[model samples]
Target: MKWFKKYHLELLLVLPMTFYILGFTLLPLIRTIILGFQNRYTGKFSLSTYQALFARPDFLKSISNTFVIALLSLSIQIVIAFIIALVLKQRFHGRSIIRAIVLMPMGIPTIVSGIIALYVFGTSGYFNELLFKLHLITKPINWLTGNFKGLLIIALADMWKVLPTLVLLLLAGLDSISQDIYEAAELDGANSWQSFRFITLPLLKPTITMAVLLRAVDVFRIFELPQVLVGKSVPFVSTFAYEEYDIGDLNGSGAASTILLLMILVFAILWLKFVDRGGSFGNDS
Candidate 1:
């Protein structure tokens, strides 16, 4: 009671967010858990929905594919963003213009990005036209047909959409580093690479960890890019969940959703552990 009175201003600011989470997140999560355990058709409790979901090899494949794509997409987005941010951190004329250009991707809608990617990667798309005009290939490639290419297209689209956000995050991280540290390194005869290796990367670890965690979760839950690109018939987890829901397999969908929620939880824990380790590393210094 005494602590509450002391922190009352902070509590007042936090209460609205607390209620919002309870109303939307907590309530929906509880409902989903209850619904997943029941037969949607009969409204009776049963485990058959989960059993049926697990019975398929495709379901397993989708789960595996989701992780693979998410990891690859997140890695690519982070690396590209980090490189761009580092380059832009240097003072130069037109630096602001270049930074604004990097952020342009975030302004475009994901659906729009997906559509653009589809058009570009489709059989009769610009890529084929360019390749054929150069006599690189005689026929247009069916880029979306195979396992790897389909995954690549989806990852590419996601990477495109996500790159701007990552760049902004890394830029923010870069800005947080003290310029005095760089000056000290310069005084000690350290080169740009040495300064970055010792000072910038270590300080940016927390921000990079945060960016990776956010991007990983977003990529894991991605639907429209892969779905619009390859369709629901493709074995990706989000598409599979949508397919189940579309076919009125509500219980199965819920169970699959529950599994996804659990997967997210597991990843969340891992990310937290990673962040804690990074924090400890900072503390040790």
Candidate 2:
């Protein structure tokens, strides 16, 4: 009680966030879990919702595609962002302008990105027109019409939108490092590669882990890009849930959403464990 009294002011600062989380996150979570096992179709309780999900032919494919999209998008975005961050951290002309340009996509809504993608990659769109002018292809390729290619465009849109934020995260990590460390390495006859390997990377592990976890979690809950670009009937889990909802399959939608939530939670736990093992998220320096 005495300890609580001493920290009353500190605790007060977290009150708003606590209520926000409870209202928007915790309450909805409890409602969803309750609804997931209910037979809303008949106003009863059963596991039939989950059974229905598992029975669908494309259900397993949707699960697999969800993971593939998240993994591939995360990997490509991180690698590209890391390289760009490393380059941008160095002194250069118009660096701030370039940084703003990279991050501009993040400022745009995800739905807008999908619309932009539609313009650029839709059949007879600008990309195909350019290709035609350059004698690249006789006809415009349908970039957003098929399963595999549709998924690819969705992933690419996500990659383009997220790359800038990832770059900023990595850059902040780079800036946290002291210049003296690099100079000290130079004095020891260490080259750029050696310095980066021994000093920059090891110190930046925390930031990298944080960025990856954030991106992975974001990718999992994503609906806009995939839904807008690929349509609502495709195998993406979110779109599946949408279809369920459209047909008044409330319980089924809840069940699928619960599944998505579970997936994200599992991944978040694993990521936290990995970060803790590496001591990346700890306050120790």
| Residue 41's lDDT in candidate 1 | 71
Clashing pairs in 2: none
- Compose the digit string of candidate 2's lDDT tens values, residues 123-218: 978989999999999988988876778777888888888888899899999999999999999999999999999998898888888898899888
Q: Please name the candidate that would achieve the greatest lDDT relative to the true structure.
A: 2
The digit string of per-residue lDDT tens for model 1 on 57-117 reads 8898889888888878877788888899888989999999998888888888999999999
Off by over 4 Å in 1: 1-17, 40-42, 133-136, 187-189, 274-285
Predicted candidate 2: what Cα RMSD to the true structure?
2.6
Worst 10 residues of 2 by lDDT: 275-284
Predictions in order: lDDT: 0.84, 0.85
